[model samples]
Target: MSQNLYKTDAFTIEYIPGADILKGDFLRCKTSDEYVSAIRAFKEAYERVLPRYTFWDNTRFGHIITPEEQKWTDAFLNYPGAQKGITEKVGILVSQDILAMLSVYEIFEVGKAPLRPGFFANEKQAMEWLTRKETPVAPLPDTKPLIAVEWDADNAKAVIRMEMEAPDLPYYLNRFKRFLSDHDFLVENLRLFQELTRRERKILSMVINGLNNGEIAEQLFISCETVKTHRKNIMRKLGCSSYSELLRFGLFL
Candidate 1:
């Protein structure tokens, strides 16, 4: 048995008892406020269902999110309660519109949500993938994840599709991985700085200003060897591999 859980002019959410999945079909463009409200209603329904459930999100007629809305969506995803372990898998069916598909991809790439997400071209394929009993922990053989986009001048829209075994997955993954690495580096550096001594902090400040070891020692009236030791300690504490890496961390200060 399936039941309608929520609906608006823009979207409808339904619960499928046979598949134990919450499926949402987005019907039209929505203002930021409307989008937020829809998501909140969806979240409420998700919690009412109890234990974790898989999700089917059909956005074949959806609109792209504005930059302001993207910020709001990111904040919502980062909220502690947003991830109540209520979802185990998510299948998103995207529109052919390039901008809309880009928006969907941005949600997956940048949204800080805990979800195992896959992209599909249609509802049937999405349901089949989402309902599978066991998922592979490693990549499948001979296939690659792909995100394909094409510009259609006639319609003034983009034709976009993404799949788990499309050839361009690595390119997208590499870009996202760099973002994660930089974010982690900044967070880790901030934590490590709290452990620095007064003298080390002074030395680190000078190092960040592009001072060489000897120049730092001269400025602080310390021995060159002592400056070298402090620099080494600072690098060890900050997990910086080289001077250039340390400079990158300096941006946070």
Candidate 2:
């Protein structure tokens, strides 16, 4: 049997009868204000249940936290009754979003060493760590996996699906941007490589290995003028202004 301690639009917290564990997760975080309220409710639930072990699954959480809200959370964690010692161990199934992780860190950072919070990438890992057993107890069977789809028409006509948030969001966003740029370059390079003749590809391999026109001509028993013509065509098809620019594709091509 389980006792319901906290119930909100954003979360559901319950206390297990025989296990003496308080377990819950964010249901669907629509707003940052709602997240703050849910945390308050969580504290109230903790005051009543006072479980020895706890687990929070935050896989579906998506909140754009403001700096002022962050300050409130810090203050809430520092309150006299907060983290005064209730739960001995905590296992959290964290969200994939890098920014949502900041909230998890802020909430539990106030706890003493005895609390010993464990962050997990998946529910199986969290449950195993919480129970200290080989087999996991699946608690979130009804919950759906988090998936967000975003299509950028301006860039490559591709779809990128990842819900990002604040507090180091710029760092992750920049990383994604760099990845997109590299992906675009590779796609264009592959298109050019596909358009080349079989002989051009073979010559390109040698050229990419720092072979000059005369060396490539001798190895393939072709004229230097033939190698030069192929080199010119390769650069034209690959949209490279110079040999140096085309040489960058040595590894990739």
Candidate 3:
């Protein structure tokens, strides 16, 4: 058997073969806990055991909306090695009932690009739909012109949504790439933040939260002396003399 890639998060466990989907409250992607667990379960069950993972996403049904929803979707869609078993992965399922909740443009695109091939009302119907081979229709043509792109400097986050027709897609995407390049500082900071040791980051986070040595120790289940040591180490690594300064520089970026 292949070694499990995601043993840490509970979310990943659901997709594993023989996974107890009952343990997962799969109503929707609400919390990080759910996302992490579902990801782990799915990774082990579907992708690892079998050679194909047949699943459905309810995004077209208006299930997902927030950025967190988008993040988890991105994770599952773009997860490393998750596609090993998936030859023809499905992206969205648009039903007549769901169509009423969305727009004409939305349904049109779902019927065009980004829609799953075998979209049915239920999983069984979907499986049957997938069994019968059918040619996928090509994506709709884009003929709109480009305009502008914007990002949130304070949050160091990018939002690509804009009001435009389909033809402007190419220019809009090109502008998005340029926006990403222009915000190199935020990107570098995010990379460094990810690279930092978990404990180090946790300690820095606690310090930024205005916790004293004892409080930090209590929260982390470590001793006060250990908390002091971690504090000093964090300050040294971050090159900050005071907690306020560290919070200002380290947390913002």
Q: Write down the lDDT of every candidate, Cα atoms only.
A: 0.67, 0.68, 0.47
Q: Model 1, stretches more than 4 Å misplaced?
A: 77-82, 135-253
Residue 57: error of model 3 in Å?
Answer: 7.3
Best by TM-score: 1
Q: Write the per-residue lDDT of candidate 2 for residues 138-208, one digit (tens) a residue.
A: 22323333457666777846664654322233334445656787788777678777898989989989988
Give each prediction's root-mean-square deviation over alpha carbons.
Answer: 10.5, 14.0, 16.8
lDDT of 1 by residue, 1-253 (tens): 8899888888788898877888767776545665677777776776677424545454544566776666666666423334565456666675656565566556645666644366665677777777777652211225544669999999899998767532134335446667898888778667787888888888888888888888988988989999999888989988879888777766566
Higher-ranked by lDDT: 1 or 2: 2
Clash count in backbone of candidate 2: 0
Which of the two, 2 or 3, has more TM-score?
2
Who is ahead in lDDT, 1 or 3?
Answer: 1
Name the runs in model 3 displaced over 4 angstroms.
1-29, 57-65, 68-72, 75-86, 91-118, 135-253
Judging by lDDT against the true structure, name the best candidate.
2
Q: Give the candidates in order of lDDT, highest first.
A: 2, 1, 3
Q: Report the CA-based lDDT of candidate 3 relative to the real structure.
A: 0.47
Candidate 2 residue 47 Cα shift, in angstroms, is: 0.6
Q: Which stretches of candidate 2 lie over 4 Å from their true place?
A: 66-68, 77-83, 106-116, 133-253
User: How much does candidate 2 score in TM-score?
Assistant: 0.46
